[model samples]
Target: MIRPSILLAGAVSVFSPFVMAQDDENKPWTVSTELGVIATSGNTETTSVQGKIDAKQRLTRWHNHYIFSALFKEDQVTQDDGTKTTEKTAEKYFGSIKSAYQLESEHSNFFVFGSHTEDEFGSYETYSTVAVGYGTRLYNGETMQLDAEIGPGYFRGERVLEDESIQRESGVILRGAASLAWQISPSAEFKQTLSVESGEDNTRTVAESSLSTRINDAMQMKVGFNVANDTDVAPDKEKTDTMTYVNLVYNF
Candidate 1:
């Protein structure tokens, strides 16, 4: 089992020196919360909910980001005995933290990243990774920016089998990621991100695209699509999963 507390504590310890040297009062944290919900009745009964929190802090030489998100869905189904019941159809939780130290260059940094995920109905029941890498700005323009990173990492995960058995897998991995952000207008923004982890046992890939339009100074509406894929999976499981959501975001 990959312990989240251990990884978080390690990250904090690695960055404690920078944290202590910087004056936190002058550098405030920025946070955003997003929520999406859906409910249906009548012919078909279903409910779905998603929530996310994103936080960031910037000091003189260090930048930190934290993210947590959860999704849950339930559906009403008719059983063999002609009885109707509600059953959970999907459940997933994910969290990640990244801290970067600015180098002498204008847009370059060294970063440490850690993430964990739990999915009740996916190929992998639990997965976690830690990596250290160098990142740099690939493009800087008036309305668009791009950043990319590559690193060697380690990952451990639990895989579900066709027989309803759990198998543990762990290995060294090479990770690469990139992000693109475009300011379409003063109140509208578009973003895309992709990440891949290649290991001995399996290769995992994730991609997300989102567009947000500001409704006010502190609120916005966003629509996003996310996809996750694994090269290796159980016989009865699909290799890919996708989600589309519309959410309300509050920023502070």
Candidate 2:
């Protein structure tokens, strides 16, 4: 078993030097919020909303990142008997935090990360993960950047069954992730992220892509698409889910 206390001590010991080497004046924090919504009426009635927040702080030796996002969707449909009803088709939320310790080599670091997720209709009531790994910048240039990371992790969750009973699942897993950023122009940028976690029970993968165009110094318009897949799921459950959004982002 991987003990959290041992992991914490190891991470602290490895990152302390970087933290001690940082100068005060160079540290800065960046934060942003994004909101999106879609609505339709008449023949088909639907409403969906999503919101996300991101924050990052970087020092000479350490970088920290945090993210939170939530989505809710409901649609109106007519029953086979001709009656109309409003049903909630989707609801999900996720949050994560990570910290990276800069190594002596440029563009390389060791990181610790954790995340939790909840979905109203998903296979699990709540899913959580913790990982530690090494990360490196694959490409960095004026207009584009790419980074990749790999590590070992643990996953534990309670799943919902058709009988309304809950079953617990826990396992050790491997995690791999990559991110890309492209500065298309002064006022526009594109981003993509991919992550995968595999364990004996199942493998999960997620991909997200988005483009943002600045409307002003403090705001931007963004279009994002996301896909999530699970290699193993209940017979009555789906193997994949996808979402699309048009978001307005505000920087603070």
Candidate 3:
């Protein structure tokens, strides 16, 4: 299992150098950290936590993005022997980085992306992917914007079987993604993102929708829903997973 501290440290190490090297006169880096937690005691003991970090940097001709997220949950349950014990119910970690080179057109760019995921209780134990693609703004309006991208990529994944055996799958895939953002009001915003990767053995799709309202100059309240689906999975496993969360976001 991947620890949250390890993931946080890796993210900071990866971005610290670039952040420190930037000049004051240059465009500043935009970074946001979000966290949510739930805990219960007495009658039932349960704990859940989610955290995410997002960072973006734009230079004269390059745009870069970094993301890291983690989820963990634990519950106290009675065993067959009537003994109560705390056990982890869910754990997941995900990280991705993308860099785009700005073309002559302001809305078009070429990008290379890579991502990795680890899920202790999902259909897939681990997955990693890399791709190169061209992206462009499909629409730009006063209050909304849309962007899309497509490319060929490669992925490697480990699937868990009914017998608890691990099966490794690797193949080329076609990936496509789109995102839309709307400014609902001066202090509120809504965003939706979707992505799909299709290969010979399986197809994976993910979608997220979120709404955030500014609380202060550097803080916001956000609610989000996320879903992930796999076309093929073990007989004992489900093909889809969903998450709903409310978080506090700190931006800089």
Question: Against the true structure, what is each candidate's TM-score?
Answer: 0.89, 0.86, 0.90
Which candidate number maximizes lDDT? 3
Cα lDDT for residue 134, candidate 3: 96
Q: After superposition, how far is residue 87 of candidate 2 from its true place, in Å?
A: 1.7
lDDT of 1: 0.86
Q: If both were scored by lDDT, which would come out higher, candidate 1 or candidate 3?
A: 3
Each prediction's whole-model lDDT (CA): 0.86, 0.82, 0.87
The better-scoring model by TM-score among 2 and 3 is: 3
lDDT, candidate 2, residue 88?
90
How well is each residue in 124-208 modelled by candidate 1, as lDDT tens digits? Answer: 9999999999999999999999999999999999999999799999999999999999999999999999999999999999999
**Model 1 misses residue 130 by how many Å?**
0.5
Q: lDDT (0-100) at residue 204 of candidate 1?
A: 97
Q: Report the C-alpha lDDT of model 3 over 115-212, residue by residue, as the tens digit.
A: 99999999999999999999999999999999999999999999999998999999999999999999999899999999999999899999999999
Of 1 and 2, the candidate ranking higher by lDDT: 1
TM-score of 3: 0.90
Could you give the C-alpha RMSD of every candidate to the true structure, in order shown? 8.4, 11.0, 5.0
